[model samples]
Structures are given as structure tokens and as C-alpha cells.
Target: MVILFNKPFGVLSQFTPEAGHKALDEFGFPAGVYAAGRLDHDSEGALLLTDNGPLIKKLLDPKFGHPRTYLAQVEGQITEEAIKKLSSGVEIKGYRTKPCIAEMATEPENLWPRTPPVRFRANIPTSWVRLTLTEGKNRQVRHMTAAVGFPTLRLIRTKIGNIPLEGLQPGQWRFVQEKVI
Candidate 1:
């Protein structure tokens, strides 16, 4: 089964039990289904889960370079120079990232309220940006934004390849056709 899940903030990507965090198993996906790619507990957005081994491999293989798009709300007003720096790429954990797309974006219109909410600083303004990357790295978006002088206040994934976070609310999942994707 191919499942598109809208993972909520503070939820673990996997089904394993953890203290003070919700896991995928709690949502009752079919047994043997596993996350093709993971989103950290602090991030929210589109996550793919499937039981097919070959399908998972195809999605995750770096050579395939499946693009994932994220909408990040960053601290301070995002500058053109920062967008250029992001597009050119940034080094994380000592490894340089591949060149990808980044642009200033308006706050997403239908965003759900985060539980507990992102931190607010009255004196510090925030801006939204759309970032697309083909490689999945540990906290890559957070690291990239901070490297460019705008620390991310909130992160959300909006799309993965052809599938998007459409129609699903936080913690909701729906089965999809694997072949169509």
C-alpha cells in the first residue's frame, strides 16, 4: 500500500513507542508499512509510507533524486541575498548541498494551527520561503536557513514528487495508487 500521511508536529515518523511523542502506529496504518522518508518530530508535512520494499527503495535512492518541497517560516525578513545563498546551496554537517530552488513566499493560506505554536517574538518579524531539494538530510532545511541568516521558526512539507499534502489534515492518511505516482 502507498499512503500519503500529513504528519503533525511532535510526532515521530516511525511506529516505535516513544515517551511524550506520538508515533505512526497510533494512526493504525497497515502492519509492515514503513516510512519511505522521515520528517523529524519537530517538523510537520507530507510523509510517505508503504509496505512495498521495492517501492520504498525506488523513492529513497539518491540517484532518483525525488524532489521534496517545504514551506519554511524563518526569523526576520528574508532578503534577496539570503534567497540567492539558499539557491546556490549551503554546507551542513560539513557537506555542501546540491543547488536547488528557493524563493520568498507568502504564508500558506490553509495552514493548520500548530499545537503549542511556534515561538513568537513581537520585535522579530518572520517571512516565508519555498525550498525544494532532492536530497534528504538530517534537519537540512533548518540547517540551511540558519546558515543563510534566517533561522527557521516553523517548517512544513507541502509536496513530495507528484503527491502533495492535499485534502489531509494533521494526522490523517489516505491510500494511493503506487503505479500512478
Candidate 2:
């Protein structure tokens, strides 16, 4: 079985709770299902879970070049130049990211309010960028945006491959057809 979970902020990707952080166990995922990949504790959005080990390998393997798309709210009014730079790729933690899609995006129409909310600054403005990456790296989206001068204030994975979050609210999970993988 395949599952799609809309992970909430402050939740760990693992089933085990750690250091006071809530984990997947709190969400009541079924036995035998495990996360195909991880979303960071502070990041929120679509996380794929499955019972099929081969499917997990296929989805997590970088060689497949499966796309994962994120919506990032970053500091400042992001410039076209920065968007272009992000699209072309940037070096983060000594590794140059693979070229990916990056473009200015309006806030998602169905966005739910974040718990505790993102910090607001009276003077500095912020903008949203839609970034699609074929490679998953540790904190890659946050690092990439910061490398180009705009630090990410909020990040949410909106899609993985062709499967979208599709209006799933935070902490919600649903069984998805395996073919969507």
C-alpha cells in the first residue's frame, strides 16, 4: 500500500518521537508502512509512505531524477536574477546542486495557516518561489535560497513526482494508488 501524508510543522519524519518533537506515530499510520523519504522537522508538506521496499528505493534513488517541488517563503523581494540563479543551480555545502526549475509564485490559494506562524518583519518584505528539484540534498532548498541572498522563512513540499498534495491538510494521510508513484 502507498500513503500520502501532509506532514505538519514540528513533526519528525520518523515513527519515533525524539527530543520532544512529534513523529509520524502520532498520526496513526498503519503498520508495515514506512516513509519513502524524509521531510525535515521544521518543513511541512507531502510525504510519501509505502510498504513496498522496491518502490521506496525507486522513489528515493537520485538516479531516477524524480522531481520534488517546494514552495518557499523567503526574505526580501526575490529578484529575477536570483530566480535565474536558482534555476541554474548553486553550490551548497560544497556540492553544486543539479539544475532545476525556480520561479516566482504567488501564495497557494488553498494554503492553510501555519501553527505559531512565520515571523513577520515590518520593514523587510518576503516573496514566494516555486522550486522543483530532481535531487534531494540535506536542507537543499533552504541552503539554495540562502546562497542566493534570500533566506527561506518557510518551506513546504507541494509535490513529489506527478503526485500533488491535492488539498491534504496538515497531519492528514490517505492511501494513494501505487500507480501514482
Candidate 3:
């Protein structure tokens, strides 16, 4: 079985516990499943979980090129040129990123507010962007946008591969049957 979860901000991606934080128990998952890829404790949104090891590998492996989409709220005004650069590729921490989709999103309607909301600065305007990456690198979206000069203020994953966080709220989950491609 495959599960698509809308992980809330500040939640660990693992079933394991960390000090001063909650675990999968707090999110309410049935025993025996594990996360396919991690979303940082500070970041939020769509995370996949399963008991099937091979399916997990195929989804998490970079070679499979499964697209994971995020809605990133960035600090400062972003230019169209910068969006193009992100779509093309950007060198972050010495390695270049694979080409990905980056576009401005209309203020995300019906987005559930994050617990302990992202920091806001009176001086800097924030823009919402939709970013899709096939590779699951450590903190990649945060690093990529920062490298491009518009630092990400908040990040949310809305979709993973063909599954979306539709109808799910933070800390909620639903069981889905695997789609045979």
C-alpha cells in the first residue's frame, strides 16, 4: 500500500523520534510503513510512505526522475529572468541542479496555515512560486532559491509524482493503492 501524507511544518520525516519533537505517533500512521523521502523538520508538504521497499527506492532514487513539486514562498521580488535560471539549472554548494520547473503561483488558495508561521519581515515582500524537482537532495529547494538570490521563506510540497495532497489536512493521512505504470 502507498500513502500520500501532507506533513505539517516542524514534523520530522522519519518514524523515529527526535528530542523536543513529536514522531509518527503524533501524525497517526498505522505501524509498518516508512517515509519514502524526507522533508526537513522546518519544511512542510507531500510525503510518500510505504511498506514496499522497491517502490520506495524507485520513488526516492534520482534515476527514476519522479517529479516532486513544491510551493516556495520567497523573500524579495523575483524577476522573470531568475525564474528562467531556476528552470534551467543553478549551481548550489558546488554541484549543479537538474533542470526543473519554476513559476510564480497565484497566492495559494485554501492553503492551511502553518503552525508557528514563517517569519515575516516588514521590509521584504514575499512571492509564491511553484517548483518541481526530480531529485531528492538535502534541502535542495531551500539551497537552490538561496543560490539564485531569492531566499525561500517557506516551502510546501503539494504533489509527489502523480499523487497530490488533495483533501488532506496537516497531520492527516489517507491510504492509496499503488498505481501500476
In Å, residue 55's CA in model 2 sits off its true spot by 0.8
Global CA lDDT computed for model 1 = 0.91
lDDT of 3 by residue, 1-181 (tens): 7888888888898877797666666776777899988899888888888888998888777788888899999998878988999999899888999999999887677888977987888988888888999887899999999988999988989888778887898888888765722
Model 2, backbone clash pairs (residues 3+ apart or across chains), number: 0
- Compose the digit string of candidate 2's lDDT tens values, residues 44-70: 999999999999999888898898999
lDDT of 3: 0.85
TM-score of model 3 relative to the true fold? 0.95
Global lDDT of each candidate: 0.91, 0.93, 0.85
Per-model TM against the reference:
0.96, 0.97, 0.95
Cα RMSD for predicted model 1: 1.3
Judged by lDDT relative to the true structure, which candidate is superior, 1 or 3? 1
Best of the candidates, lDDT: 2
Q: Candidate 2 at residue 155, lDDT?
A: 98
The order by descending TM-score is 2, 1, 3
